[model samples]
Target: MSVTLARELACARSRLFGLRGVTIEQGRILLGALEACPRWRERPGIGELRIFRSAAGHEVLLVPSTGRVQIRVAYVVPPIERFDAAAGVLVELARLGRAARRAG
Candidate 1:
């Protein structure tokens, strides 16, 4: 599963609807952060859905699939562009993951 997840993450494409705002590079980076984070928990009421909430109140939803996982990022305070907001979330999540690993 991890292998498949890794592959999917590597090739994942992120976009808000059909708008070409979020690039594949951004998606790959965000997905890697999700995989590295320890705060993620399987969301209740969904078998394959996982969610991660950053300390900054950004909620990231991930639905894993064999072909392609759908990733959605929601901001408590919406940004000008959804694509522009993912980098901040990714950085925070990655920092959290690093802290958790160090503490453990």
Candidate 2:
């Protein structure tokens, strides 16, 4: 699907989750990554969802069944540096990816 279509779907899905009392910003982030990269691996038994790395080198684990998203940043250097730098990169990439799709 086109990026614009994908974004629309993501937003709609997020709203659905919100109605069900689940927040979905993180889920949208992971969905954006999957849309931009399309390199996620499915883990059926674990959570019936997919796993992928964000552009920031953080592991984004998405549980579609539960509408739960987890961002994991390694503490190799320092806690602050790792999360801040990696999360920054991930957020920037997500934004650029979405914009690129819309522009396309």
Candidate 3:
């Protein structure tokens, strides 16, 4: 399941965000962040996903759940293009996660 999820995430990053390549280390880091969330299993719908700019100018991916808040990704760059790309990847992740949860 992890293998398939990784592949899907990679494809989404490349195709949707126009990322040339997502290194294994980055993928692992992102997946690790997601796994660390206590409410990771309670997949939030894409509409519920929130993107916000941090005070340090990073793009943050926030997933709101019942009792806990899940922050999925944080892109360091502040450029609009980077933020758009990060948001796109995040939205795709939420969509995939939601579908997987429903299927299961």
Candidate 4:
């Protein structure tokens, strides 16, 4: 993780602390999911906003967009299984990224 992102995530964790409907543990899991997936886009003019979309269509929508962090979860998938699958996808993507860099 980039220094800026790490800082942003820390701030996000602080912001999420004690908020209703999202437990501290859940917040950690959600942030972990965000870190696992590759970044989708950086919304210009937003400070340290991290948006990630997995290939399987799970999303970690973090900071400022909705004025809150949220996971737009695919309801058909259970939480544990969904994150497990996401980890697999991320590993493949990382391998591909490394291969492409070497090839180039």
Tell me how far the alpha carbon of residue 75 in candidate 2 is from the true structure, in angstroms, after superposition: 2.9
The worst-scoring run of ten residues by lDDT in candidate 3 lies at 1-10
- Cα TM-score of candidate 3: 0.27
> Quick one: ranking by TM-score, best first?
2, 1, 4, 3
Model 1 lDDT at residue 90: 44
Tell me the TM-score of each prediction against the true structure. 0.40, 0.46, 0.27, 0.34
Of 1 and 4, which scores higher on lDDT?
1
Model 3: per-residue lDDT, tens digit, 22-83?
Answer: 34443434444455444334333467554433333333344333212222233444334544
Which regions in candidate 4 have their CA more than 4 angstroms from the true location? 1-45, 48-52, 60-75
> Pairs clashing in candidate 2?
none
Please give me the total number of clashing residue pairs in predicted model 3: 0
> What is residue 43's positional error in candidate 4, in angstroms?
7.6
Local distance difference test scores for all models: 0.44, 0.44, 0.39, 0.41
Cα displacement (Å) at residue 9, model 1: 15
| Candidate 1 Cα outliers beyond 4 Å, as residue runs | 1-45, 53-57, 62-71, 75-80
> Each model's number of backbone clashes?
0, 0, 0, 0
Candidate 3 overall Cα lDDT vs. reference? 0.39
lDDT of 1 by residue, 1-104 (tens): 11111111222243221212334444444456566666554335366555555554445654444223333444344545545556555455446545544555
Task: Write the residue-wise lDDT of candidate 2 on 47-103 in tens digits.
Answer: 365666543345555676565545455334354354354445345545644665575
